[model samples]
Target chain A: MAVNDMTKLTLGPIAYHWSADTRRDFYARIADEAPVDEVYLGEVICSKRAPFHEADLPETIDRLERAGKTVILSTLAEVMLKRERKATEDLAAMETPEIEINNAAGLFARGKRPHRIGPFMNAYNEATIRWMAGQGATHICLPGELPADAIAVAAKAARELGLGVEVQVFGRASLAVSARCYHARAHDRTKDNCQFVCEADADGMPLRTTDNSPILRVNGIQTQSESYVALLPETGELIANNISHLRLMPQAVDMVAVATVFRDVLDRARAVDDADAMLRSVCRTTPFSNGFYHGKAGYRRIAMASPA
Target chain B: MSLAELICPAGTPAALRTAVDAGADAVYCGFQDATNARNFPGLNFTPDELAEAVVYAHAKDAKVLLALNTYPPAGKVDLWRQAADTGTRLGVDAFIVADMGVADYIARTHPQVRLHLSVQAAASSPEAIRYYCESFGVKRVVLPRILTIPEIRQIRREIPCEIETFIFGNHGLMVEGRCSLTNYLTGQSTNMDGICSPASEVDYARHDDGSMSSRLAGFTIDCFGADEMAGYPTICKGRYTAPHRPEAYYAFEEPVSLNLSRLLPQMIDAGIHAFKIEGRQRSKSYVRNVVSAFRAAVDDIRAGRTANIADLVALTEGQKQTQGAFETKKWR
Candidate 1:
């Protein structure tokens, strides 16, 4: 097991507002067909999204667990309100699904209980990872802004501390989160009276410059990259650096098919070129970018060197 | 505890002296390297300059807090460590840090130095603030601009650390320490590289329509009208068009600065200990004007008199201001 020959695939927490049926259906399909080893459920972006899917959570968890998927609950990404604090505490007290600490509030609420640190918590270096490990962090999904060299160093440091290092492999990269909802504000509504307009844009509303160039995607309070980040070509490099997990953030796409492509590539059953082709076919709206890992503009897609 | 302290910014030694002479209770600054957030050219101070500034400020009964806030990559933490060592030897009153690694380095190496949680850490809730106080012995936390006065009171009641809130200057709506918009555009991050909208990559051009467009790394951030005053292209304040809304608008935030002068009394009543003015990249005159205005306002509040806000309007960004989330009545 220590050999780490194959890295595991994890579905990170959803940061958008999806309807109850849509979420239930999405998780159902993922539970039935996705080859992901673990699935994180719950809201990480806004607390408002919690009520919409709170009712369907148990059924969704049951379905995912029945399929032998390791289901983990994710805490809020930015906890400020009193209700948010209580909600985080309640999430930490849950007995079944493990908790992923997206905000530092979760770390404090969860105390020394074993948990997974989400990318939003700013696990940038060895000291943070080591500190989280001391506080009973078993896994850490580092921030997506890290380049390949930073990722390698963090992965090595995490391994030394006996923790799993998970990096986001595919999805519209998150750029920022604000207290005020840009999605609501854009629709001529305040954050309080948003009326859940974000649900309309399944993948998030595309924001472009005056020249109509796709620049960013706005999901309620969160800002994301217009281009989806695909790391199918960099799996070999990630594995070589001892990365234990690859996180595929849930997007409004055929995620099951997306997971199969990653699973096949990791299993050595499909070539990287074929997988990349399959990914392009599934990803329709946004261009593919791997620039963050390359230490360049996040929207730039660097052509990987042909498989070594 | 008697009155809220006036923490001001000092981009240079002149600004430092200006702020201190203007009745600043403390001055926060950083080194010129990428170890600090304001890594702009011709800004910040060297070790020797900082030592001199500290001596000058201490003579005026003002404190100097060194900002080693930017997160260093795993193997590249030495620069931050070295900054902390230099800051300690220079006799800085406190270290404003965001990354846990930086805080840990400061805590373990120089346990006596006071540690303040930078807004970049985005520790908004009480539990989050408690985590830092429990882990790194952080003495103060600079609250993000997102919180309300009531929220601050609630956190102050729940947490053990002292609280500092930005009273004026850039009103960043984005959650601090978490934003990557600058990195997405310029391949640089405010948290990681200590730069946002790096001035080197910023360009301004006049459109064919006779409007001015501010660009960040070749991407148009915001286009200003003929009569409009164009502010620096902070990515968050940029106007952009979305698929749902074709017309360009300030989708995230408008080009306005925060002036919490009206709510100074409420903030003080909320147990806010330090009132930080955010603009380390600004000038000595701007520093003197803002610090003097806020200093007068704080004194007036203590003497139970009217604290005027109109006197500071000329210094606000784009000549516009907002109470921000502190006075925000909107629900989220």
Candidate 2:
């Protein structure tokens, strides 16, 4: 596939604080088996998780790149601490394995060096994307909440600026990131001594409404949807609008098979209905939602009308 | 030591007058349209009212900082552009902006008007603050309510722009400009649409046991007992259940307000250039009371006297308040 092709499948950086062994194995499988065109590596959620997986980054990058995948290093989404700043600076200084900046600190440190704007960066509109392009951003991942109309506008602006536009096609949509760690707070602990409680729930800790309905998932400081955003049916519209890439955030499921299903649908070798069933089986119990694309509540699964 | 300027919220023209009269150094407000974050029914100032507000505030020796903070949707950049143009024409002392596109437009077109980075920008780190300062010539940045006093002091030392920290009202625990929780449930973005848990989508139901439940778009945000003081069902402040806990709890933050009154002396000593108060959706009386309290507190601290802080528990949400993330990072 061409680098700028609309069918390009990119894997987003893991938002959960998975163990180093789990991360290594996950990336190894993605490198050798997944049909993804690009792979985003590094910690995007909590800064504390970086140390656990930073040592194995070089090997992971090499393996992914050797497997003919374009590798992108993602920076932390919420940068506040001294070490977080230092981490962003160190990542910004890197000349290889293009950086995906999630915070303005990365934008500052990178300073007009070509990079990708991560979904957390809030490239919500044409003006923002244009300004991002001016800041030397080569690609922009539109925030998951943006509806179809907004996506069309943003994608057109990005295309006009000669920048790649990517949208999250599958995975739990990140809703919020805070300075305070709800994951630690949930365990009755402070972030300073979080004891890596988030590692126990590799996908994310399930957070339900008071009435026993699961509404959100808490991963450290970040809040995400309980349902994975599956936009396979909307891929045709996205491609027609010139969206350059489709992103899949790594959940605790069989992501390689998930990528294969999306690839098959994108390639038109399989029907969206068939791929949808395949994804449901691969994900097992997690529900799929496409409401954000349809401009409804993110958790609502707006079913597309069946063909005549 | 130079006393930190007391910036106050003015949701309406009446609120603006009340704030100015109550000794606000500057009153920040937004237009009635979606250009600002406080987009609610019967709140915020019209352009003509803003023009009059500028005059009224200027006469009282207080500045009017226009908030054009929300991100302009695609193909609708003109709304924000026109807002900047109107604000410049109306002689707004500064433009409180969040989006890079809006900031860039203001900096380029209205170079003479000062640009204050809204907390909605979420420029928490020194590097992030410096980028805004250098690129857009931002004069002041309203720091997000997610930093500790030590972190603010560190950032103040590193950055060139003035730092403004929230001292009272609305404990904004979530990282602003980045949160999409409200959007996820309501399909109205807090960053793009400027309202969170919009009143229009909110519904309250009464149960047989004399209990009440508040919801947003059919999703149960929280339920309250008869004796409990029910707060607005904001996504962050609502109660939730986790597997680790036995029952439902305030998963994100409790229904509490942020009152940094006790930390006034320390905040002033830390070289904070301005002290901000949230709640542009509040009433004129709320504006008057908070501004008056903070104004007196700031004055007392500046004069080397112990600040006689007023009890503001009645005005706080759920009748509770916290210093929250300002005193320590362990508040989580």
**Candidate number with greatest DockQ:** 2
Assign candidate 2 its CAPRI class. Answer: medium
The pairs that clash in candidate 1 are: A192-B331
C-alpha TM-scores of all predictions: 0.97, 0.97
User: Any runs in candidate 1 off by more than 4 Å, and if so which?
Assistant: A1-5
How good is the docking of model 1, by CAPRI class?
medium
Query: Residue B281 of model 2: what lDDT?
Result: 81
Off by over 4 Å in 2: A1-6, A305-308, B310-318
For the predicted complex of model 2, DockQ is 0.79
TM-score of 2: 0.97
Model 1, B109-128: lDDT tens digits are 99999999999899988888
For candidate 1, state the interface root-mean-square deviation in angstroms to 1 decimal. 1.3
User: Taking the tens digit of each residue's C-alpha lDDT, what string does model 2 give over B1-332?
Assistant: 65599999999899999999999999999988889988999998878999999999999999999999998877788999999999999999999999999999888999999999999999999899999999899999999898889888888889998999998888886898888888888888888878789999999988899898999998889999999767789999999988878588988888888888878889999999998999888888888888887787788888888777655434464467899989987885
CA RMSD of all predictions:
1.9, 1.9
The ten-residue window of minimal lDDT in model 2 chain B covers B309-318
DockQ measured for candidate 1: 0.76
